[model samples]
Target: MNSNRLPLFTRADNFVKDLTLTSNQLLLIVCAYIALILNLPFLFKSANAITGLDDFNWLFLITFPIFLFSITLLIQSLFAVKWLIKPILIITVIISTLMFYATLTYGIVFDYGMVQNTVESDSAELLSYLNLYAVVFFIVFAVIPAVLICSIKISYQPFLKELFNRITLFAGATLITVLIGTIFYSNYASVGRNNKDLIDYITPYKGIDSIYKFARKHYFYPPLKFQLLDTSPQIINKNNNKHVTVFVLGETARAQNFSLNGYNRLTNRYTANQDVISFTNISSCGTATAVSVPCMFSRLNKSNYDKRLATSQQNVIDIVHLAGTDVLWISNNNGSCKGVCTRVNTQQIATTKSNPLCDGEYCYDEALLQPLREKLHKLEYDNTLIVLHMIGSHGPTYFKRYPSNKILFTPDCQRSDIQNCTQEQLVNSYDNSIAYTDYVLNQIIIELSRLSETEDVASSMLYVSDHGESLGEKGMYLHGLPYAFAPQEQTHVPMIFWASAQVSNSTPDIDLTCLKNKSTNVFSHDMVFDAVLSITSVKSKTHHIKNDPFYGCKSASFVPLPLLESAKKIQTQSSGEH
Candidate 1:
């Protein structure tokens, strides 16, 4: 806080000039400020959730801050040293303040899932969160307080005495928190049990815990050797006709908003008349791309998913590639594939040669269509898998997802501060993005259809969103709530399947009518692995018939004797472990 350099902050510097406090005192004050002021989102949400049937429980409201203050104080006391106190305090307060902006503005929960998404977000994606409101909040809460912290002089005692004092502070804070919890046991217990997500709203501590967990998984844990589910996957029922399937990994497209799935709006206008059928009931593996994208591609299910283990293994793409299929990933998404595309050949659109469709920061979903059209002509393999990873409906700039000329909905919200927009305007913008997605998909389908008819190749497409979005529902906006407390808006994603006549005529298992009838049945991202394997005719023990929606209608003649023998051998070999 050099007054000469930052002259505007001179008053702030002068205000704290005479303040000389012991390290313990400074720690307590910063902790208190952080717990109360920086935790407005936490307290407000908790109050809303636990106000009961009446106005409020005044006693519980008072005790909640005391609990938060005690928790923060105890955490800070452990790091209370003359040389370290102010630095640690400043860092924590600054991060807490930023987290405050996100939680307060978008109702985001700083759980491990969201921490993954935040860390992996690219510069452009990160910048979308910035606006005038965020800047003002940062200046008033973070910068000003940080300057004051640096300006205030910390008093020192003898080293041993300072250590003893810090120890006492730690003990006192811990005892007070424990005593408060014990006294308000019934109130705290009931509220917490009913509202489990309240734990994630404990200011920046929840975020700190998530970061620590992420670091521990990526750093502290021993390096894991890359493992494959099966190394001997084979393309079964091989034929002369080439097979092409476009696996469209969608972003933030919930099923509820899709007209194909009964939404009132014509969001799926292009696909409505196309041969595609939308899966009406399907949930995502996780609420954010960082978590969902990886899990959706891996040999992992939501119940047994482990981030470290998933990253250190061959995903569905690798298995398909290994089965002698030429696989390529084209991402219009800035949030790279979260390690899912590491082993596959990938092309990032935003980094390529200049295009009129791309505006430096973002490109419309149509930007994906031209390359897709060009690639369909260059096919040199019998079985081909092209993944079009779309940046669909990612906010808080939904208006940027599609072009102005393509805007199908009126009075769309065009600003990043979506909270300030009317609900109708916000929803209109989101629906327009959905309609644009249909147009892009329709273009890709037309290209695939041409290839199928002209080149006699079997063409098909499968589209599934990584997760869903929340458009100011239940006073919550955006996505990434903890999965346990996540609303359906963040999990019930759209999955659509479209196959040219060649796919059904060539691929034995793909009974389109049967699959469409089963579309209304419950399914999840776990089914993605098997569905892809079945569509591409890749056979391995890992491709469970039970998980594939097309398998019931699969012809028994398609199963080869050697594949059956291999399955038995693998099962017999691994049966001892269980």
Candidate 2:
């Protein structure tokens, strides 16, 4: 060959000869394809629940054109660069990096961070956006180069020629992919869900009004003008010795694991000593704070919560207000749901200190007492209702749930990420947070007791968890499961009440001993309204007298265990049993 041709031929031969693809590159491609396949099923699943807004401005629409263009460019680049494996891999890296960042950021933004306060009905829309961006961006900017690099790595021919051939082949594939996606979207556009269906499935006739009310409460700039249903509310037993009920809402505390409920561990050493009623079987209404907090506070039942959400006449707080008691809601959790305490006097401890325990400006549950004490001191009146919402055992940041000094376990006082530690370590960190909670409650009780003594006021403290947390059970890390399918851990939480001497004196015959030894297996957050009413003797017009489940209305239902049948034999010889 001529010298000029020799140089070109030799370079081509070297490029093709040296070209090879590694397991990592092939694996990446396979993974990307798998992701695409997986997304298709997800898209189909979410399609049924699509809203009109989704149909109109789906991410697939915008990404289709870019996807086509990207695939075309990638094909062309592949055949042009004979030894472009590194360049293509670099492109893939860029695309994957962008996707990784997008996914990570998406989790953060929704996890605890806020957006423009715009609500999207389907979370899949955001995921779809990310998927579309990844597909099109990779096809356009990364594919051809990646194919060229593979060619160089795998072939023994001229780099440029190999790149060209590979690009030509892959470009065809790229076009086919884009064409398929576009055609699918185009044809399915008219078939997707619409506004009427959204109204039907999510907000029915009765629910529409409620949905509108919820929207007004959370998103409506100018609030909706609505009147309280009961204008002439009658108070029951007006003379209850200036009753004060403090409901301390604990976060993510499981009842079964609590030592107060006979758990193997000493998790409830401090609470066990207190003069309190530990309702053993108390279950949360929902698994997520967003759903549970709102549902628990709202004057709605399981059957009507969705429908009544928007139009519920009043919440528990509002009921307290109408009953002539000062209502206060102090919280540390993210405002994911509607501000349940919006109408009530609200204080947020999470946003108070500069350096708080968790990610946000949220301090531990103990911080609630700081403002709570002040609020109590400021209150000149004897009748008041204070709701202390604790940022209890919210994980996977169990270590941050409590203070560093409160760590009871030795060797490691606390850990921000329990997953990074052993199972024992994680348990220790979690239990420590619970221990701190015990201390916080003790302090609140002490303060309340002191107040009753000093000012001659009557007070009672009621503690109920919004929901329980799961600690490495069945591959689930946190709460947010649908209530119907949630495990026992997510539902069962510690419910206790520590009353002041004056208040407990009135209910002198109240039995708290059985509460310590046995399980009140039928209790739920739903009974909260009636329980509060019964304890305070506050009667409201809406208080359903007959169906009120908390008023000595224990269900005569029990789960049968064959293993317990052996108790007959064991009991016969259990005269000396401890």
Candidate 3:
């Protein structure tokens, strides 16, 4: 060989020899690559959604991948034992798959609230979310990488040398990550504050961190104890007239889709024909059943409401029961009343087998009706409060909420995987659920009317949903987004009020005309506690006059409602409901 050629050949041989890696080193590299592949899509989507790929966002896109890579390397190095690699990788794959599936399917950012909901959700509810598409996606993205990692041949090195290399790699990666983070400190902080969901959108790291935080907040933290607002609430009986109030607590019903609220769809057909008063602008306390149910029943307003505090004390049910009225909570929804019904007479329709309307696990909202009628028949109290918590339009299983004969809209999405359906089909399926709810409400009203006629009972029925739902709007589906960032579709709920002639005549000061005018007025979950107390004639110091929708019904001040002025303005733009 020529002298120059020999030197080039020698250098080439040295380069090839240097490329060889020990099993630990190779595993670290594989983990790092997998992490990047799993996280990059999320990072890109989150950055675009937040900052729209502007200069500041570009900086994030460039640095975030590096940060993720370095963190994965550091983690792999710290757990560098030959036996630990497969287990860690497998766990990573599983979690990563779940995170991807949720983010893509529902457009949800896995924040602390999401983590809390996940932990609190039952097996059935969780299983309802699973489908073939999500499984396929998980296999393709997560399982494929894991399989590759497991199949690779690993060359062993001396334990001491491997340990030294692992420590050195971790230290180097940590130093680099810290340096990058420090340099972009201000930019990161600004983006994080402005777009809080960005942090939540980051894959396995965010998911794990949120779960840890949720656990700490719920389990490790000290229990919050608060005084019940109306410990000695009392109902003042006027004329000794028998009063019966049926409070229907609905699930995922939005005002925008209700014909009573000026929507084009005749979703509220039954309620429209009746003398029901529908509120056009009503916002929910929270975007999920878990939070909204407790909040609605609590004296606390949105500004002051704390989940811990809400759970600790007696709510509307306790106060109502204390006021010498028989209170009963009948629920078709799987979720409990979040401790609100702990002291009240509660019946769960989902648990009963004798009711043909129920199938043990899932049931139509009408399933609550039969149980409610039975309870009503046995009621011995002159003044009674019956709460019917309905499972109305809960999705992406909207088709299942209503029976086959009740599906008013054609081309309804039958699949649980809503993404597989067209936008029109999805809307049709959801609207059909709403129509069925209308039918259920009409049946309840008819039952109430029958009781009022047959017995000496003065009756009324009030219906309000726990929270509204998002139906494929801007790539968002379902509810439970954090309240601060949730769109109107997730918060603007429907409310209906109907009173029999006897009950109306007894409370003659509650002007029906004034209430009809105030139907277009803005209100929120904060009004519910006081409104219920006012309607039931439960006098308590805890009830705020300003929060009561009927407080100024007979006064000139009723025209320009105070609550409407103070409440959040409703967004004019509308979206499809679930």
Candidate 4:
């Protein structure tokens, strides 16, 4: 190998053979390549976010790129070993290309929560995110560069010389970072503190950081034993009639889109006259199903919600099962339950290809109803709690969520790359999905009502979404941004409840009028644990009256809207805010 250029054979052996590069040169090239090409989304976002002005400005032009490049250079210098740099750079580029596509298209960040979601997602979910556009993007951005990188055969310096060069390079990079940072302290401080997610936008590095964080927590950390929260919970309002409660866990259905929450369209037409109380102002624990589903079921509130901690401890499902209520989880949303249903009986309908409503890829929410009816007919326990996890409006393929005949909205986007579609088309598809979810929920309500009348069971139902989604609002798409800086479109979700005449309006029996009066009042997933316990009549030590929203809305008396807002304001102002 010549010092200026060397011919090293590649597996394919197609590219220019002679590559004149040293390990130090390769390191600099890799760092520069990632900082400039792979970090375009991050750089562009930072540029826009930093500049309050409409046009491109000078301060941001000078400050961010140099600082970010210096940081990348320093990080790359740490791994500048002769044999290690190529593979490392190749891997970084490949993974970051996908991340870059996601961030540029949907404004997603590879935060810890997103990493967890990615690792937990099933094949169907994974395939949904892939398309021709994504393939082309990856090929242009990742594969070609990786192939070129693989072809590079570098010259090496003497061991002592290499070590000294690396030390000097590292020191120089560090000094450059410090100097630029000091020069742009005000600009950096303003953006960094106000936009904590600015750090998350750093491509490949943030993705790498998230992967390490998730792995360390899941694999390397000390595992905690499965906690049994309440083996013997207090069952209230025991009566001759059986207690049947259906908790429908919704997926990605936001409150603002539902007609029940004053959407201009009748997206919630099916449930409009079903005598259900829609909770208008409801916040989710997290912006993704992986976090929200488990967190809602767990004893932890959103403020203290940790996936590992929440999963290790027994959730509401476990408590419900222990209270002698036969617990059944009917899942149409694969991977959305996030192990919350592992302790209980579960039936998968996500890929029930035999079902007419379902293809091999996914099933409609109606797939849950038949099994539920069968379970109702063959009821073994008087007190039963059934969780129907619906794949409601989950995107970027919302068009596939419902059957063709159920498509109430026209001009719906049929493609997976929703960014290519008009806002109207995208929303039409999403609205149809939401409407279909409501139709399914209405079916459940009707079935439960019939059971209450014919089989003499005290029945009720609650449908609450795991999280909301952004429909191109403020140049964002989908959910699973970091919760700290996530928009309301990804955090505020829909929650609704319905009770049959069999459920008397009294203590332990929630009053509809009272619940309606507090419909506009604020609530969060923090209240779901105790609310579920209360609804299922499973009263454990953790099921406090303060945490059960229904328990407070037992009276049929109505509070004025002004008073409700004032109360909400007070509640939000003080401690223990959601």
TM-score leader: 1
Best by lDDT: 1
Model 1 segments more than 4 A misplaced: 1-13, 48-50, 53-58, 160-168, 351-353, 507-509, 559-578
The lDDT-based order of candidates, best leading, equals 1, 4, 3, 2
Residue 304 local lDDT, model 1: 74
lDDT of 4 at 451: 91
Model 3 lDDT tens row, 1-578: 56466677676555544565566567666766556666665666655653653545566667777877787777766666777766786777678777877877887767776777667666767877878887788888777667655655566657887677677777888897898789877766766767776666677878888888878878898886555554677775656777888999998998888888888988888888888999888999988877888889976677677677667666777788888999888878786676779888898775555666756668888888788789778868878999998889888788889999898888999988998899999999999998999999999999888888888678888999988888989888998887888889999999999887776566423677878888888899989987887677676656666777877663333223443432222101100100
Instruction: Please write out the lDDT profile of model 2 over residues 18-132, one tens digit for every residue.
Output: 7565423343353344233312322333344333333444555445334433443443344334344455445444543343333222211111111212142123222323344
Q: Model-by-model lDDT, in order? A: 0.85, 0.55, 0.77, 0.83
Q: Give the better candidate number (1 or 4) by lDDT.
A: 1
| TM-score per model over all chains | 0.92, 0.59, 0.86, 0.91
Give candidate 1's whole-model lDDT.
0.85
Residue 85 CA displacement from its true place in model 3, Å: 4.0
Residues 56-155, candidate 4: write the lDDT tens digits.
Answer: 4486567678778789888887776778888888887888888889999899999999999889888899899899999999999999889878887888
Instruction: Write candidate 1's Cα lDDT for 447-525 as tens digits.
Output: 9989988988889999999999999998789999999989999999999999998877774647788888898999999
Question: Candidate 4 — what's its lDDT?
Answer: 0.83
**Steric clash count of candidate 1:** 0
Write down the worst ten-residue block by lDDT for model 2: 107-116
Error of 4 at 4 (Å): 24
Q: Which candidate model has the greater TM-score, 1 or 2?
A: 1
Residue 221, candidate 2: how far off, in angstroms? 14
